[model samples]
Target chain A: MVLWIGGRAQGKLALAMQKWPEAKILDVSETDAKGKEELLRSLEDALKDERLVWNHFHLFVRRALLLGMEPSEIWEKVASFVDERPDLVVICDEIGNGIVPMEPEERRYREETGRMLCKLAAKADCVERIFCGIPVRIK
Target chain B: MMILIVGGSGCGKSAYAEKRIMELSLDGAMRYYLATMQVYGEEGRRKVQRHVELRKNKGMLTIEQTRDVSEALPKMQEGSKVVLLEDLGNLVANEMFGEDGAMTPWEIVADKIVMQLRQMNSSLDHLVIVSNNVFEDGIDYEEGTRDYLRALGMVNAELAGDATQVVEVVAGIPLMVKGKE
Candidate 1:
């Protein structure tokens, strides 16, 4: 039930849960516009089942994982439901998309996110990474 | 009770079992080894032969079987203190997939193998089951491959659920996690 989100070549990190048989699918990676509806359906299905969980943390690079004061407060709002709900999907992104920024805010953001992912991955049953769009498991 | 040793390749389950037998005997405890690895290849056969010779030199009772591990259940001496089931991984492969070849129809065969292994849990005294944690494969799996992987996890969980001790053997060191050995 843990998810590791990191840069490319992290695919190996995301393999532990998939290796267990009781783990059922709430949803898998489906980012194409055409697959959005299915993704939503799967998310709903995932909400219904206890076994469905996810590990692809950084593929959705556009969306930043909600963290910090306002974001953390927002997540706190949903924390109870996630705990109460059976099925869930965890999404991760590589904020370290390139060089570590010299700017204060950017670097802090990167460090915070990366640290969060390492903590999550440690709890996650699996972790994975992508490079040249090819997924390699890292956990 | 039978002891089961479960772990991945190079995890030292066999060596640990031997050490356990040798050490336990020094305290006046009687034990036996029930191994599932067979001498099937020139290289593998020789490796097994070396193990056999070593056990003989140490004057240990080692039972080596390539198939039908259940057959070894009844041969233990009465009032014996430990029964070491050296592995479940290879036994599953050899019993379900045949030692020398594939099972023509794998489904029915896998079922039979699971059945036999589950039965072994009940038929032994102090079993220490060994298996490799195979979950680190990151790629998605084909349906059949996934099914087998699932079964492997289930079997491990069940054994861990009932075992008196669960140890993770890493770099030849046994980290006790669940119970007394």
Candidate 2:
């Protein structure tokens, strides 16, 4: 699996689309996957495609949280799906660099996002960080 | 040599910049910490105090100059001087909206700040500038904040072009965008 992580609006999706023009994109941001089961179903369906790009993976994590799923549980399900699809491309935003949010939900979201990215970065075969539209390979 | 370090808030850019300056400082080379942040409130004071504590025994003299960074050039001791401007964001804000700041267009302000920085760079042996990546939030800010971002972005671009090295620190990991490591 390949992982591309960066801050918001850094052209990560654009670069991913350009790199794999034929890949089927499953943008979690546009999905209505309200719970863990539905989210997994979507992932399973996307896996039917040979090449896949998972856009806005950060939002998926957030949705999982809002749907009352534990971070660890979400990670386990997501990890297995990614492991099953070696050709999967994950695009997520690095959202932990900003100030600590006043809202508890925001704080939890930021923390969970960082944790998931760290695990994904370690698991992915290739990892790149997009900085102001420049892709720098980190791993 | 001029190095520009960019990063988002709390990504450890400041710590990385500090370590880099220490590594780059030569023996007998005077190090100056050009603090451009103007302490405005209790929070700001606390932040400054924390930074002050961090720099202890680093062998760098701190010079608090919020605006017109070139003004500090005359105060440095005669030697090979290495200066670290704590950040460009605060400097831009101070120059654009501070009590003594210029009440002009952001483009003009950007040009003026860049000129001052170039002048400052010419006088120092090594200059390290710390900057922020506040542009990535995707939020639609008001016109004033947008202008601020424009000014800061222009300054960052111009400085990056002139700098020998440009780095973006993410989670304390230094990603080299330009020049040799």
Candidate 3:
């Protein structure tokens, strides 16, 4: 299982599918971010089964971490709905340079996301970033 | 009859072929000039046009891709056996490689070329191929040049495999390598 994250145009998921044929995939997007409080709360509720969760983007991981959640604990929580499945992939958009975020929320999002990527990349077996339709191995 | 026609640079391979075709006076025969050179520049473009103009009659057909054994096969006319392939060295030297200017896997390329030659052997009546015989003066070569020579060696082996006649054209002289007359 692998986690793919990139911007709107990045074919991270597509690259993952091509690279890892054996992996089963799950995707979460901004569309699911309609209601933040409800979504986060509901996500916590859904993470009860204690199965392995391959986290893609930094949002859910960041949320749980900020809420004093450990990586193993967060993965354990999400495991419940994930069929107690041994492995899975999580994805998110990491490098979106559309426009410099003038707002506080946007800046925080950027900083936190960058930090999360750096941390995950060090621990993960394989870490990649897609730019201009080509994948670059970062870790 | 099988022969290997070899000559020095610009020793009249095209002219030799046209005269041979006219001399044979092949009735209802197909005369094809299998060309390997691709015209990416002015020199190439003009040279190719000159080859087309060198033809004696409208019976002459030009097959551009000489490197490809497969493409070279289909251009052969039905019921017409006599075939002429000119400047094989350029074709074998150039194509069948990648954009990095590196040669592709010669084993794979050799297999494909050999397979096509087999098909031609069974289909065509008489085959006349022209080569530059670059073996005269060997020089220090980089990886690409070395790979090309190896591939060319494979091509030579494959062509020699089915050729009943091999003639080496040297200084306007035809030296028979494996032919009866």
The runs of at least 3 residues in candidate 2 whose Cα sits more than 4 Å from the true structure, single-residue gaps closed, are A1-139, B41-56, B100-103
Put down candidate 2 lDDT per residue, B56-170, tens digits, no spaces. Answer: 6678888899988889999899879899998999998888885854455789878988899899899888899999898755333687787887788778877877889889898
List TM-score (chain A only) for every prediction.
0.45, 0.95, 0.54
Interface DockQ of candidate 2: 0.09
> How do the residues A80-129 of candidate 2 rate in per-residue lDDT, one tens digit apiece?
98889988899987777656778888888888988898999899999998
Q: Which candidate, 1 or 3, would have the higher DockQ against the true structure? A: 1
lDDT of 2: 0.84
Q: After superposing candidate 3 on the true structure, give the runs of residues whose Cα lies further than 4 Å from its correct spot.
A: A1-139, B21-25, B56-58, B75-77, B100-102
Give the winner by lDDT: 1 or 3.
Answer: 3
lDDT of 3 by residue, B11-62 (tens): 6655665566544446656666667665688887887788677663456777
Q: What's the TM-score of each model vs. the native?
A: 0.57, 0.59, 0.50
Model 3 TM-score relative to the real fold: 0.50
Residue-wise C-alpha lDDT for candidate 1, range B44-110, written one tens digit per residue: 8788778767766876567875567666667656554445665666655566555365552445444
Interface RMSD of each: 13.2, 4.2, 24.4
Ranked candidates, highest DockQ first: 2, 1, 3
lDDT of 1 at A126: 54
Cα lDDT of candidate 1 equals 0.52
Query: Which candidate do you rate higher for lDDT, 1 or 2?
Result: 2
**What's the distance in Å from true for residue A55, model 1?**
8.8
